[model samples]
Target: MSKLAWLNGLPLEEAKAEFLRCCGSTRWAEAMARARPFKTDTAVYSEAGWLWSQTSTEDWREAMAHHPRIGDVSKLRERFKASGAWSEQEQKGVQGAGEDVLQGLADGNREYEERFGFIFLICATGKSAQEILEQLRERIKNPPALELRIAAGEQAQITRIRLEKLLTSP
Candidate 1:
């Protein structure tokens, strides 16, 4: 059977677990599981977006907690072992980054967390480290309320990508 079919046929708790792998918010995962039997990839994507928008800041923070700081290879391998492989792939640009760039990312991550009270989040799928750093530099200047929403929006994009990966990965 196809992946979508497999997902649709899973038991409720199992389905929630799979959805949780895509996005860490328990509320979003539970809701997505209950909204199952999606007819098409587009429908799944649409539902994911809608469900993410319905999530609260606390829920967004829960999802954000799942991601390692960009360029932190050790954290990716050790702390976030469950999602490490996928995250490593998404952050491929960091693999060949120079020491200065890596150091900048580390410092920026600290500053961002201190300011926003959460990790800086970006889609990171196809972005270079320099690009991500530039974005972090820019986005860090936003006010707390606006930055939270922007980070949540980035999480939404990440959820869509991970949903596609979940459906397509064997």
Candidate 2:
């Protein structure tokens, strides 16, 4: 059977768990689970985006907490084992990065969290380490309110990608 069919057939709690794996917000997961029996892949994507847009800053922070600091491969492997493999794959550009770039990401992540009260979030699926670091530096300069919205947007992109991955996974 198809993945979407499989998802639609899952128990409510199991469906919520699957959606939670895509995005960490409990509210979003629950909403997606309840909004189940989606008619098409497009419907799933649309609902994910709409639900994300409706989320509060608190919900965004809850989702953001699920991610490890960018380039922190060890933490990804250890602390975030549940989503570690997906994160590591999304951040593949970090692999074999030079020490200076890695250190910059580490330092920038600290500064970002200190400034914005959350981790530096980006859709790292296709971005290189240097590119991600450049974004981090530029985004760090944004005001708190603006940064929060930008982070939420990035999280939305990540959630969409994860949802696609989920539907395509064997």
Q: What is the C-alpha lDDT profile of model 2 across 93-148, one tens digit per residue?
A: 98888999999999999999988889999999988999999999999999999999
Instruction: Give the number of the best model, judged by TM-score.
Output: 2
TM-score of each: 0.97, 0.97
For candidate 2, the C-alpha RMSD (Å) to the true structure equals: 0.8
Angstrom error of the Cα, residue 93, model 2: value is 0.6
Model 1 lDDT tens row, 41-153: 89999999998989999999999998989988767878876677889989998889988898999999999999999999999999999999999999999999999999999
RMSD of each: 0.9, 0.8
Q: Predict model 1's lDDT versus the native.
A: 0.92
